[model samples]
Target chain A: MSVKNEKKFNVVYGEAVGAVAAHSFGEPSTQMVLRTFHSAGIASSVVTGLPRILELVDARKKQQSPIMTIRLEKSYAKNYEKAKQVKAQFEEVLVKSLLESFTEDLKNVTMLLEFSKEKLAQSDLTLKFISGKLQAKFESIETEQEGNKLKIKYKSKKEMKSARTMFVNMRNFAIKGLQGIKKATVQQDDDGEFYIVTSGSNMAGALEVDGVDKEHLYSNDMFDVLKVYGIEAARNMIANELKKTMDEENVSVGFRHIGLLADAMTYGGSIKSAGRHGIAGNKASVFARASYEETVKHFVNASVFGERDPLKGVSENILIGKQINVGTGRIKLAIKKEDLKKVDAEK
Target chain B: MVVHEVLSESEAKKVSAEYNTPIDKFPKILQSDPQVIKIGAKPRQLIKIHREDPTGKYSAYRYVVESV
Candidate 1:
């Protein structure tokens, strides 16, 4: 880049870019409605509007509803059937889901589970596969399979409470698919490419699926992205997420402002909230930290540690009613000791 | 994600001198970060990142911290 162009693009020294970015976000955010949208009965409802903005900025570990969009490889992307196969790997199928009816013989200490043929056929699972899984999971229990019905009996006599516990465990036992993923639906994009949308996110596990487009696999969960990709990717996700949320609310904000905020949050190698627990709490000036939140705690700690306020930041300087070190206030003039000595004390 | 490259000892020293800042004082990237692990960078090392924006491309530096 040329020096002139670089100078034009460069942020002015001591410019209050952070303050500007904060205001940019804060102003548009007030107009956003507190609404979460549900997409029919297939995909999960995403938290949007003001609540989502707060969640992203706060760096909350657990999102209210995490979702993933798993794209497919070139060959699989055009066919719905092929996409369904990939989607099946993520939709968790439990033992109870395959059963037509479940009955327990309390006197004989045996549980009879009748498998639904239609459910088994739809899931592409065989009777033997389920029986084998059951035997592997419960070693002490002996399973007898006759046709589509399987009978489970305890090796030793157990109390009613123990029998009930065993019944509940057997009913909820997972047969196939990745854990943490509740549902996966194959949806077509605007480009007519088939992609899987899952209610829960498991990026690592989703990547291991056969036809998944690993490069394009995206999760709404920020921490999951951090774990699978890294800080830089997380930073991009933050900016993109913020932009997307605002767009959903029909609010337009400059991407530069959002990018600046995202950079501030993740530049420290980890996602830090903009609130008192993160950026504000870690300020260098004691007065700036005290003025943010937990006023007494900050002052007490500063006193005990004998901390000195640099009075360089805007907040600290403002607190003492001084010109903030920004824009024109950032300029200072200095005269060398030799130059001063050259002039007489009094004219 | 942007491309990341681990700086050699000499290069790191040169960067420190150019920036007039200590190596440890730069913005940090965790040692366990996926990109760091991919490039096999150790703690206290320096990473040069190449990022693209709407304006153009730019380079940023990060100091590899053990955690946090």
Candidate 2:
């Protein structure tokens, strides 16, 4: 006879999300050095640094000394809290000047946007005059085809400068709003508001304004998301330009919401993303324009060639050394042709 | 191994609430490295948490049965 035993059971799960955050590394050529960590299944990666030295020989039994190399990287951690800490440290060390760059970016983008509007206004004078002739019921937009002799499909419609102005201003506002975003230590309030209070303020009084819901807090409020993140792509163009400052400071700005960000940056312009046709797709290299493709290729080729040492193999090994593989291998096994015949006869 | 037939934050919170289970009460090893895990954690991921809660004792367990 047997008795049955019972136990209780329950079910549960964990939540995960894709994150956009800045990363850092202790050295350059960090990838190879960090591959070992990956081998052990750790979620960390390194990019660009050298483990060995390079030497040059000018002449006369003399060799040049090797130069020191450096590496920089952004590391990703599986744990969000841990990742946030590393991100905070990286920004403190490298991204301090981002605030100033963003301000300059806002000014530059504003100027460009104004210039574009003026050019558009001047080129379509005839359309502007005809736009008033159209009836208010039509409320139609006047189309003109004048730039580079391009043809306009609307032969009798009118133009709306106010609409254009609204678009431009919205875009500009969006640009200015996005300009001051920096990746650093983000503090989360008890109510789940996220704010990045860096060492300095890029927005001047914007950060100081008081409210229950402060500016720059990504509270996931739809209005806040729209006011800040959902800005027109012009804001992104300005933001992209501002990122050059990060480069100057030896830092990097991670790509924001690449879709809406691109859309806003290229607003009243072009739509670019990865599909059958995209702006980046036209470029053959696998990276952005500023990335180092040629330098990377040259270093890789030289390192591979050095290890092989083709010149030394043929000239030194073949010519200077005795017959190679003599002990391990032989021209013929055991006996020469003449010696084999004599040995057979003796047997 | 804790098998989750369905996984969600709300569900995890609900189940933890029902049972009053704490995070530290589960069969898990805590370490600072996060890279090294005990209790069948694979290389890429550090550990497998059973969706434990801080107020594990707050949850309650209940069952129903019919007698012939």
Candidate 3:
């Protein structure tokens, strides 16, 4: 590498990078839009702006709205029909979604389920498919199908309460597609290539579907990325996601600061939040941990464990009004034995 | 995943000596990690990762720890 490039990448020892990263993220975040805008149609509502920054930093297990952008294989990407077919494999269909109305005939101990023909057509499912799935779920119950309806007869006539419970259970039964995925929509990207954007994320299951571009699949959920792709990918995701979120708000920040933050968060081989419960909480010095959060808890634990603070870190030294160990404060004067003998004690 | 290679025992020792740190003290990667599993690495092994940065490319080292 060139000297200039080497210098650009090297962080000076004793430089407070954590403080710099914090300031870099903190200043621009003030200008971020507070409101989250929901796009029309079946597209997932993305959490953006200041809220998104918090979501990434906190590393929340359950996202407000997790989304995934699934790319297709080369042959399928150029065709709209192929992309739609892939989308159907991800969008889940529930029995209740296709039902028009369900009526229970207590006298006959039967339930009449009215299926909406329009919904069935839109979902690309037939009466047979639905009936077959229902039959598999309840083998003992007898089912008779009409034009757009099915009549289910319970074996035991007098058990009215059990029949009511069965109705609730049948409605929630998933007939097809990956579970947890609420909806999937096929969209055309800038290059006229078709892809699928889903409201929910099921990375492992989605990867199994045909025509999916396994290498390029992306999810907004950090845990999913960590679980599927491992630590390095998760680290990159954090930095890229942070940069993308900032770009959407028109805020300009250097990638270096964001990269530094990401490296610090994942250098320990796992994603850790920047605050109290994670990185901050794991500081080696008791005083540093106490100063950040849960002050009394940290102090009591330290005392109980007979923990000693070396007073090496910035926070601990600052707490005692000593110079922080950074920049010029990092320099210490040393007197050689011969020089010490030469120095006047009185002076 | 980034481009990575599992180092031999001798190579791992050389890295540990060069960095002036013990092998176990290095940053850890779980043995069950997908990338580690893909590479078929075992516990107490070392991995050298080639990372691409906008400024330049650099190598990072990780120690494989048994998954608990």
* Candidate 3 lDDT: 0.84
| Clash pairs detected, candidate 3 | none
**Per-residue accuracy of model 1 over A10-125 as CA lDDT, tens digit each:** 67767899888889888877766433333224353677677788899999998888899988999999998999878877888889989899899988889999999999999899
Ranked by lDDT, top first: 1, 3, 2
Q: Which ten residues in a row have the lowest lDDT in candidate 2 chain A?
A: A51-60
lDDT tens readout by residue for model 3, A1-347: 46466666577777998788889887877756432343224353677777788999998888888899999999999999988888888888888888999888866778888999999999789988887888888776778999899988865565777777777777777788876689899999899999999988889888899999998999988889888988878888899999999998789787778988888788677888989988899999999998888999999999999999889998999888999999889999999987787786645
What local lDDT does model 1 show for residue A193? 96
**Winner on TM-score (1 vs 2):** 1
lDDT (C-alpha) at residue A278 in model 1: 90
Candidate 1, B24-68: lDDT as tens digits: 988889998999999999999999989775435777789999978
Q: What is the C-alpha RMSD of each candidate to the true structure, in Å?
A: 6.0, 28.4, 6.0
Question: What proportion of true contacts does candidate 2 retain?
Answer: 0.00
lDDT measured at residue A173 in model 1 versus the true structure, 0 to 100: 80
Off by over 4 Å in 1: A1-7, A33-44, A94-175, A304-308, A336-347
TM-score for chain B in model 3:
0.91
In terms of TM-score, the best-performing candidate is 3
